[model samples]
Target: MSEQVPQLQQDPQQILEHVFGYSAFRGPQQAVIDTLVSGRDALVLMPTGGGKSLCYQIPALARPGCGVVISPLIALMQDQVEALQAAGVRAAFLNSSLPFNEVQDIETALLHGELDLLYLAPERLLQPRTLELLTRIELSLFAIDEAHCVSQWGHDFRADYLHLNCLHEQFPRVPRIALTATADQRTRGEIAQRLDLEQAEHFVSSFDRPNIQYRIAQKNNPRRQLLQFLRDEQQDNAGIVYCLSRAKVENTAEWLCQQGFNALPYHAGLPAQMRAEHQRRFLREDGVIVVATIAFGMGIDKPDVRFVAHLDLPKSVEAYYQETGRAGRDGEASTALLLYGLEDVVKLGQMAAMSEGSEEHKRQERNRLNAMLGLCEITSCRRQALLRYFAEEQLEPCGNCDTCLEPPQTWDGTQAATKLLSCVYRTGQRFGASHVIDVLRGSENEKVLKFNHHQVSTYGIGRELSANEWKGVVRQLVVRGYLEVEGEFQGLRLTEACRPLLRGEESIELRKLPPKARGERGESRRDSVAADIDPADEPLWQALRGCRKQLADDNGVPPYVIFHDATLRGMVQAKPQTPDQLLAVSGVGDSKLERFGEAFLTVLRESQAAPVEE
Candidate 1:
């Protein structure tokens, strides 16, 4: 006996304030909403925490029918639905996790117009039965989340996303909005083409995440370095540590646990149930860390993640940006720390070269890897380079990254470059960096002596620099396109770009090897969100957090689903004592004010009543 929900046809601004408790629209959200409400299509490229959801959610509630959303991840859909439901909006999701009866109930509700928003995965929405059902109900719009998946060049591509253009073909009149947090110019074009969004208006927001401090250091005992970072700065805060392999994920998680930190492992190889449970714990609990590969972070909705660390190099700038973008999602000051070495570059290069794909695909991948390496090696601002890669211009240097805080010294390396190139050529260019370094350093190792490289003209010519210094030169050369990694064993080969440097026609300036580890040096620059709180207000903050945890547990939702950390911080700072006062908080809507307003007010009142120790 379900009843059809009435569509209010309310103004978008009213919907934003009354339902979601936001005062106004952020960036291009209002324009995107207007486009959809006017029955037009939009392609939006906003950052992860840039209020992308409001672009469609407000329009859906204002329009006359349920908004059908195509999402890529089951967990993401569940989180969004829960958050919307908390705001008193009728929302539901269809995924394999639901039982048969629940699915039937949700489908029945959809038919009766009991839901304002409906979320479905691409595979399910493409089914004939689902398509048939959609035709029977009025759909306000079609929202495609993570729309970059439609591009084969995208980092998180899904084959099913390629068929999503059918939405345009099947429902020509339904206004559609495709949204993504990470997409290069090339990927954006592909997304528009594959999703049939060529005619859609494009909204590209600034890609900068200023609250995150970008720091990439040379790998010097990476495990110990990670431990130092956590213990020194983010000891009790929730964060994610990304590793490059499944074994590394498991090992890092287990090691963190042994070191007395709450940690979990997540990867495709883990059992589905375990992965789900781990993800659940990460979202619902506090101070929990998940060490995982790239498989784990596509659709995570947690907002208070304090930091994201990379123990190995990412393959491309897009992957690095998307992965690190997971942190400080609440717009708090957070850290993005990366530890890399010459070996990481070689390993990633080998992977790109050996991967199965078209030659063009392989070349693009190599170019992407080079870009990523350049990002790590650059002497200027990291944020500027990152934004530039996405075709966004940043004229001024960002004072937040490692280089800006402590600029690296540079030296004339023309002589060093010539010596290294000659060594590679003398040794036949068939050996890897290590053997080549040994030959240059006159090691007389078994391999070097056996190859008769000890008698070469360039033998021991690079003795002016240490082995590590020589590695820096080689790494920079490879990143600069003067050297290329090739063959099954990843031997270094000289490209035509190296001829000028070797022939003395061109001189090069290279970054001097840091006398100390960059990680230890950059420790003082790390900013934690907790630092924002006044020392005297610590007790009140704890009480508020405890209240949030209890309410979240009782309601069986993540703490953030009830109220984000920013909202809680607002409550603490304002100490609202009445319903009207509580409603002034940014995230407090009419629905939330009615449901949890009094409980929070009571907490605020009790805090006021406590006497000062002084």
Candidate 2:
């Protein structure tokens, strides 16, 4: 039997004071930290602001020696290293971005035991020479950031991650921790299996970011709609605008910049140096709008982004959430604007159908995309619908979204739903939403004329609603359980839930599409950086972040390893006076309390005295 590890008996607050100079832990950080510090493996799924990094960073520092962090993106490694250096920790990275001398210098530091933490790409870690070198060092632990990449089903799969099982084979004694912001059930299982973490403890945070208001607009006059969104709701805050094509990325950025906002374009096609320069400028300069494909946002560490606007529909809600999560990482209020058309949905559906995954994966992707479409088209609380997609039950509506702001007028759609369903069944359910809508509206359009749908009994009965209104009704019907997408036919079909409506056994209430004028209740807020954040408080956040950075640097861990924003927020809020008091905060274990705890306590005391003057 495995020995039961003796529990460390230090106060969390004191550990926080000594190691991270914090007085508290936020959300599940303490629980997660405890699991890791106990020398066990853990798989963490937390939101962007949920402080996932601290779960491993602090524990790495509390442990005996250097920790290795396997990160996918070289740019991400550099950003992490810089942040750690700012906090006064010994940190270095090995990636292709570095020159030979720099890489050798970092390796020498690792060999000489001069570094506490080292960030490496999976490819580098798997290198024979690198593995040979690591055999000489006394490693403390291993951490994998963005663990979802290990699964091919994931949005950002990296083939190199599949080789990480070598870490367990070579360093059997070292503990392992894998962290990611997003993963569905299947992806989670795949991660555990692929990374050889089957026995690891699992920590899943609620996948809801309530502070972000969700909105989806029909793709009509998209540029105009985006401009209106910027003018009405954005409040001149900086945001990322995602496009599907590089050409669109360039055009949109240039147009926005011409309109007097500081906008820039970034895409894979651009020169690497130019992309890096622009990204740095956006990070350092506030209120700069970035228009790019998905290339610009991932691995971006900017914290004060107020919004994430997409001019095109993302492939899935997972992509949407991960992209949007970039906004408001500072834990402030933000918005997620999605503009898509029928064409966009069709295109995505085709792509999903074409993917070389399992039938179940394709079905799930379609369902997720449909859910996203429902979120966009609904005249209800976007936040409520989004939470529901994650299987969360929310009765009370969020008052911030467009629907909640302008309440939708619902009517009894029992008769209308019956008519729509009947038409689908009679027509063999072989067509998509548009054809169904056309059939109902009695349009003499080409498809309708060809199908001779103007002669059907149900034809012309829906003239009371416009084509757009009919589209909304059909979409809403599908969401409300009266209909389902027929996978084989690639069309809409009635579900068992529709039986009651058709048989007059039940009544369905349908909300009328709000007037275009009504939907225009709020103008885009300014498209500039946020003004409400106290620039003065930034220094304190930076100082606390600095302490976090140093701890991570010294331990060769991610900054979040030291303490999460919530814990740091607690310290900034409570500034404890002693190590014993620090131990009271969450995320500080006895081992952490005994190791390097005094150093953090000193920083906290010193920080409190100077108070990080702005």
Candidate 3:
């Protein structure tokens, strides 16, 4: 049975402005907080950087007792606790990183109600000793972060999530909240069943990130292409380059460093300490590129990531969305550029086939892979394609994506498909796309002559199209299910879906690639991120950040925990002269006003910028 505690209610807005310093809640955060403080369960589906934490954190502070957050990652727990503490909330954590004595002290504090929010890993919460300790105290609520990890079909799954359902069985009256950044309909149902949140209020925020510009390009000299993209789009801004393998991550990092870019490598195979140091540097320093595998980023709290480039294909649309969502978290203009070719598709398929999972799970994984391919080959707005996958409908094309900016022209592809498919069949489907393309373009080299004297009628017949153009046709056909790259050889073979095309009964219209290279400036949307301060006050803004960074370094925490960019902008605009003047600015809570108020005010007085508006 759960221990009963006295009910205490506080105005959430008062807490929000006075403690956390937000002017108002974004989207459904207020409603979610209201429902939770009223002792009702809720399930929140918000995009990354969408203030999901505030929904639970505010309620935890407003209602009686303490909030118990079941977090999956140790780093995530630490980051969240540090941020809350900076916001003047009573937050702490009990994880393996702490000593036994420290754990005991936290447990004592929990029992005595000395804490407002206590974060514990799911594994720790399920332990017998921890369960006994919890039974001796009162809990405000049970909040689960990253709820999608409970889904067996999710990209990142943890077996221990299955045991989380016991929270309800143990404390039937305690309300629970499950929160996630990404989940499809099936995964949502799985989360509800696994965490006993079926009856909870469902709050699904918009999946669109308008600040992120979407771009997909064909692979042609990928190294050169990546360098061009970084220079043209990001211009030395901090970003991430995602690769599929550890060796490639290392090589890419080394290459980027040799080219004078501050770059580092991160993967599961690296030494744990080394990986930690690299991640720390990436977080602490400015304009450092971290070339990493998918293992590196899950709930990274950095808000200034300018771009996310993919040298290889992601396994599914969910994976792509979650990874790309990490960029431009500050609502600034960012870019998600993916460069893929035939090998990415073939290798990803082979890996999914060889993975150790149940047959049904594998089938589902293949379906997800196909969906990702569909997004890559979409002819309309890329944002629409992404949003539609999550059951969201956008009636009009978004003017932000590459398609809406530069629509791909359609061409009659029936003859090109006939030429490419015949080359594959004549070559015995024993080789991959590169070789098949070579034969199609009538490469009468020794290998072509050795393979069969180039006797096929399709040979030399495709000279009208460039090699790049023909490769495009082959890729589109493979994506459309008319051809499959199979066997250990990774050769192209015809599926039943290809019979009509081969029999000349089906006409094909394939999208033509953009003639020129696309970059951030080519988009139709205006530069949407405006400077929050006046041009005359830009130097003061830099000085304020310098002070914040100095204090953050002294305190051994991320700079954002001291004050977010938005808060600093507010300070610059307001030019507060005293503690009382600062309190009126948004994000200037009592605790922050006391800690950072004097240093910031000193900077403002030295600059002597304009007076506050209104």
Candidate 4:
């Protein structure tokens, strides 16, 4: 049991300060906590790092019995439990990772009312034995984390989540809180309907992660672009690079390794043990990068990840938001770089069309993909567009995205669009962008001449524009729904939405292609995880990190579990030499102060006594 467990009747705010070491609630946390404490229900829609856990963790401590958390992230359950235990909360998780004897011991503890909180995988919790065991004990409340998985339309949907309403059916008297970081209005309704939380109060926090600079570039030699971004900006920082396929993940990881980086590959296709080891290294070590597909990063709680780069396009805005949200989780400045191209769009569109879903499902997915592409091509603020997709409105430009920092120039491409659409139509609309572009650029290539496209009326009519420029126009047309990709060859075809532009009834303003390489834009932004540190305090910072590493290694946990980088930064700024002063630092709760205060205080005192290196 953790030494810092407060009395059963302690105030929620007291638990927040004494156990978690925070002064106040962020956003709707306090209100949600109050709702749960009063034995009501809540449906929380906060952002990734908006302190969702405290809403239930604090309420559980204040209420009568133990709080049971149902999560789908089996890989992360142990780390979550360990972090809570380190904070002096009597937290334990029942998962396949534990031996039978340990599971029996934990069950014994729960039956004896010795645990304040318990974490369980949803599938495990649904078992007959687990249900019977739960009926034998008092439960403070039920918390459903990652509740968006209940919605089939959600990107990370899990079939097991469909039956979570059983919690509501079986434990009607227990207050329930279902929480998720990413869900639009439609997905939220689906979650409520699926989880039987229709009457639960909904708390929707702002989805803006202003600290993350959103940047998307035209994919030209993506590996080189990714390497440049790493070498120039995010050197020696913990980050994640997402690829669309397992092979790409592996190849990218190996290539990065050859380029002298600490990169590892993770995908569902990898051996389970290998994936687990890579995930462990990423969580436990510093300056390590994980090159993975979408299979990774659902419940990752690593706080210091500095960047998330996507070598290919995400399928939807929700997925893009969720994946990018993993970065800058500690509220420090971070970067989300995406290298995208027309081929990515074609591939994703074909995938959506060929999926096994019903027509309506496929249509919804196609619309979602188009919206994501719109976000990429838009000349306006990316943050505003992203928020707007989730039904949250941001009135002002964020000045943090690629467009806001170096706004792209827009040109009147209505004539150019008409010419390309005309070319596609004249070329039989059965050819892909490259062939259409060749016909437009007057290339007299073998394919064009063989197909007699050189004799078409619109052939060489668009000679004024370069091949790359024509490709951009085609991509924008496809993104705006004026065009669609179909068939095995991925040929371009016109949509009804293009009628106005084709008839010269509408003028289209297209973003001018940006420079081949965006230069030093991120350099001006103080986005590094350690950007707040002072040069003169370097020695103290190193000593604090060293102390944290040693403590974590001795305790067999990640270094952040000992003390987050934010807490160390707090320590450095406060320079606390006494227990009370150290406790004054944010994230330093009574339990952590008691366990770690002396060692850090000694370091502070010794730093004061050491002579200046200069």
Candidate 5:
């Protein structure tokens, strides 16, 4: 290395306060930083909005030489570097987004020991020249973001993540830290194994986001359901609506915009420019909703998102949790609304059958789908059911989910279920839900009549209930193990568990969706950012946000990079009078206080003098 910063005293607490503008480390952060600084590896499984970045960022500043971050995507790298640079940290990234000359400049900075941290895409970092040059430098430590990508079974598996084991092989002496917001025990073990951090200390933070209110409804009219939810419950909120297919994403986005919502579509099928532009708007603008497939939101850092709606079923519980976890990142009151039905299960099954993975892999995927179905159909606390899937639990019912807030009613569906099961049996179990529903509703549809099944005794018996109700019964049957999906036939079949109910030897109670639960429920608390400000400080909050927006626009980064809403909330709560007083705010790192502290103090002072409205 050409030269290094003069040796300076370093401690995690000192770095936390002076470099990051935080007074203390969040859960397990201090321990993680201490471990990495002492020349050891650490595996941290913190939830979203849990400050996982600081687990390594603080240590990167405290240690000598430069920290190397192996990020997954170019956009993520760019965002991180912009945020860090805004914080007055000398950070740079070498990615395809950078032009040739810019890449050369970043490389020079790394070699000359001028950068505090460097972000590299694994594919580029593993190249011969990049690896050789990195070997020539004096390195501090490595931080692997989105570490779950290393697991083959994960929703966002990346082939390049499989090659990260070389980090241990090449820089054997440099300490390392791997971080992910979503990972069950299995994924965690796989992450540690694949990254060659088997000897690292593992920290598992609780996988709960209490501020997010959970709700799920049967998908009778998904578009109308989502629009109604948006209009009634959480209008003017930035959110994400996830669909199962690219076509659905496009249709939903168009439909939403026609209804006067600022909606955008994001999927792999779209052109890269279009996707980037849409993501930029969703990140930088206020109250914009992006209707997307699961391909988006892997590395997003937006903290003020108010909702995440699912138009169709996700492939796995982990995928569902990770996607919904995207909302309420700032610990604000938010909503995760899902609308699912029999179609979701059938579609997921068909996709699994058509997938190219090994039979064992397909089987595991199918099991995961079934687990997601269980979560949707659960009559108890949605949060508890969700947490239990990840091997976590809550001591009591969480009042934040639909089931717990307005408990669902149950009815003896044994009779309705019997008719549905018998319809499947008498039809030779050769029909999917639509055909079966037609048969049950006594429709003389071509398929049902063509199959010579109109004479079946069970036909028309389910006509008492509407077509939608019958579909609900079938869905519940499938969830309760009374019926099973046959991949080869693309049809439903009666399971052994159906015999007891069919013979009247057993009773089954299916959940009845409470009408009250579907209606709007009052938020348990005000928005975290909005609640922190007094009525007198509301003007100041707006001024601070406006200042942040301007700075973010000038710097060409998201507003949160300048100062997160939490930081702004702290400023309003403390009402700091001077730059020195401003340093006491949670996110006011010394560099930030020096750069933007004076401007914020001016706003606070001006707000105090403004006349109050009667």
Candidate 6:
């Protein structure tokens, strides 16, 4: 009801109520939204699902005419546009997915000032025709979604985003807001510069998703581990199971379905209709499991997904974080499960080395992959370790993950770590984890024999630990900074931190990884919102929305302009039986009350009240 803007440019609280139907804004949403609506640019580095969309979407609506949204993915644009439409915002999109006629229709609507927002892929926006059309439209502001794509080092980089600078060039008067769910300092600079927003404000939210439980499992019996995770931790919960290959995606989906879950496969290799069907099923049906490859997630908008299980290691931590954050969009608790092994690390490393990037880019990619590997092998509290990698400080352990819930046994691993480091040193630190492991086990393989690694004093010293256990120890050492893997030629090398352990100057505590426990079996609670509502209020709210939608259609406006969900909630509580009474509601201006209040109040009057206790 308050009309005053915080900081004189944005009223994020009001935007929260009016556009997003929420009573309050989440962390950093208010501040970032405030900066942008005040006619300034902002570089936002938030974790996925950290309400990044609301930062721009709400301000776009609150400001004025159509907001031009430049997004990276066509699929993402489509999903966002659908969500905005569902919430009764006059939103549309023009992308490769739309036919010429549909594009023309949207263009006409934009020219007529009928749309509040228009979403476009960066590639489409760069086209001369699209740019020309944008110049003629009543533009309120420019919003760049997934702005990190402009950075060459970013995981999802697209060359087209570099052209977004033209918006700033052409429309210097229009305030530009660039937003991304994932970005480090490097990517942030690229976003600001590439979008010509160096002078824009920067709003960096903490990179934290406290609601999502992070877990990593050794890939031994991964299928079984995944099944158990689903059965125990996520029984009858909506989730996505990601695989690296299409064949694996299909097989995993089939396996899950055979195990009596509502499983479906989705991959770029699938028939278009099949992919769409699986996506629809995942969205509409409760507790359906979508077994998919990386191609499936960029555009997904499902809010109540309970879990995201990775059957293989993700290419990088950024990609993993973004994919897993899809669960628990409603601010409820969720889980992100990763199943990985040394092979996964090697595969990812090899893939990174093969990508068509410059040497420096490849090196950074390897660093990111190594960080993911460290996460998989970390013995400390999973959340603390993950948050720390993102440069966040955490004082205590999160008591939700497998490591924290069932603490692993601690053993002094200083000697073993020293021995591992010695092997790397003696071998000239010129190999991968597997070769290091082979040398530690005193393998007489061709490579080991050719290098004469058996001559080292530390050779076969690790015979006391199993290959798997030794690997866990070595991985912990890497993650803990006792050792570092050199990116050039994928060398396993020791860092200065290793000096203390090797010299007995420090003792290293290692947790003996226990066998992963299976998740709860059988169907559990699925989105159990209270079925009961105030009987008088239910129909009235529905009727209000209905009337609003009808008015929106008649006037070529969005339903939210008539009444947002917050207003509807207020109406239900106030139970205003007449337009005059409705006009007394907090947000009701006389003009709006006169124009649209009577129809909603009529519906409110017709609704029956629930029986009240005396």
Which is better, 4 or 6, measured by lDDT? Answer: 4
Which parts of model 6 are misplaced by more than 4 Å?
1-19, 414-467, 474-508, 516-614
lDDT for each residue of candidate 5 in 42-107, tens digit (9 for 90 to 100): 999989989998888888888888899999987788778888897888999988877899988888
Q: Each prediction's Cα lDDT score?
A: 0.89, 0.75, 0.86, 0.90, 0.85, 0.75
lDDT of 4 by residue, 518-607 (tens): 556568332355567898788899899999998888888899998988999998898998999999899999999988889889999998
Supply the global lDDT for candidate 2.
Answer: 0.75
- In the range 519-572, model 2's lDDT, one tens digit per residue, is 455544442222343555555556766766677667654454455455566655
lDDT of 5 at 209: 93
Q: Write the per-residue lDDT of candidate 6 for residues 395-498, one digit (tens) a residue.
A: 99988776787665778777787888888888887788778888899789998888888888777878887778887876677667676655656677788878
Task: Give the TM-score comparing model 2 with the true structure, all chains together.
Answer: 0.76
lDDT of 2 at 299: 71
Cα-based TM-score, every candidate: 0.96, 0.76, 0.95, 0.96, 0.95, 0.76
* TM-score comparison, 3 vs 4, better candidate: 4
Write the residue-wise lDDT of candidate 1 on 1-614 in tens digits.
01123344899999999899999899999899988888889999999899999999999999988999999999899999999999999999999999999999999999998999999999999999999999999889999999988888767989999999998999988889999999998999999988889999999999999989999887767888898888877877888999989999999999999999999999999999999999999999999999999998887899999889999999999999999999988998889999998788888877877888889999999889889988999999999999999999999999999899889899999998998898888888878888899988989778988989899998888887888888888888988988877887879889999998888899999998776443455444233554677878888888888888998999999999889988888998898988999999999999988887887888899999999887
Clashes of 2: 44
Task: Specify the poorest-scoring 10-residue window by lDDT in model 3.
Answer: 523-532
- For TM-score, candidate 2 versus 4, the one ahead is 4
- Is 2 or 5 the stronger prediction by TM-score? 5
Cα distance off (Å), candidate 5, residue 578: 1.5
- Candidates 1 and 2, the one with greater lDDT: 1
